[model samples]
Target: MTLGMVALVGVGVALSARRSGREASSATRLGLAVVSVLALWLGATALLASTDVLSFRSARPSPWPLLPLSGIAALLLLGRAPLAKTLLANTPRHWPIVAQSFRIGVELIIFAWHQDGRAPNQITFEGRNFDILVGLTAPLVAWLVATNRVTPKPVLLWNVLGLAILANTVATVATSTPGPLHLDWPGAPFTAITTWPVLWLPALLVPLAVFLHVMSLRQTLTVPR
Candidate 1:
């Protein structure tokens, strides 16, 4: 895993600790803390593994399904309101929706920069530069939930866009081939310029994060109000 993953765990912990004080809902409070702990353990540790610092070569940024998976689980722990309850409930099927929102809100900006009528080296949109922005936005999303933002309606909007992005990613994943070259893109076979853990990002971290997000969302929506 990478230090970054570990860092996220710490961040999750801090967020949970803060929530515990402000959150009146037991479920939300517990979810926040638990997800924080998991993030510290699995997600952060895997990151160390991914970068070789920890030694799990196979582990990457996402580390088995922790990112969104944990995010969603954390969301559940955030407690229940009205919209939060609704959004959280269908998160299983709607998992992809959260992904789409993240892509559109956080990723579409980067896509515009790179998708300028040419294929860039990066495979997944989140894998490209400025993706650090996604890291920023997502935390804010979580923060909003923790703090009660301008209502989940906006989150729902972003969730729709996220779902769209998820579809695109799935399509891209299907089109991708692991060889000297690929079946989808007929030109270059493989290039380091584009291989900065590009495809691996979505395949590993994204699905995991998506699952977490969905789980969190479901929990947030379902907790008895």
Candidate 2:
């Protein structure tokens, strides 16, 4: 399921780039390079977890390496606005927003994790996290925008809401984890996110989601109605 989501995101980006007149070869190469690097990093993290080297329950609380990496990527994407905007401009304005439908699957996975007691309830829909609403509404909002029923202002508001929801979930998860920033919880800490497959949530999916929101906002704010 994780791989499937990752593949969808990668394909969406590559296809959009190609449609925007980017060289197919260059886009493909770039996509492959990114996938390869992430795959290797995930593999290494999984191996370390299996060896008990990345245990969230440990005394030191194994660091989530991907957090910093994703942060850096976000900074770069935001800092290099001209380059990012140029690439985003070529793609269909609605693709990034529509692609967010993948979050529905992510929410489902979170529910499963909650059922298994791997994740704290605070991060689930039954708790403080309302991210599922964003996932459920993404397609409708995207359609509205594409058909001209909705203006960029509404889309901008939706993106802002989505970002807020994402930020809340991230903060909840971080505080629930067994780390320096961890908050005291009753039953268990968020150990599952430190392991395989789930690790990709913070490592890849979150970063991609954030990028989509940022780019969509940039497009909507800068482009004329």
The best candidate in terms of lDDT: 2
TM-score of each: 0.41, 0.85
lDDT, candidate 2, equals 0.76
lDDT of 2 by residue, 1-225 (tens): 557755665676577667667799977875676567656655765675566676765677677855646554854565366645566777667877888888888888898999988888999998888888988998998888788788788899999999999999888888888878888866688888777778778776787778778878877897677
Off by over 4 Å in 2: 23-27, 51-53, 65-84
Candidate 1 weakest ten by summed lDDT? 187-196
Q: Model 1 Cα displacement at 192 (Å)? A: 6.6
Quote model 1's TM-score: 0.41
Clashes of 1: 35
Please, what's the RMSD in Å of model 2? 2.6
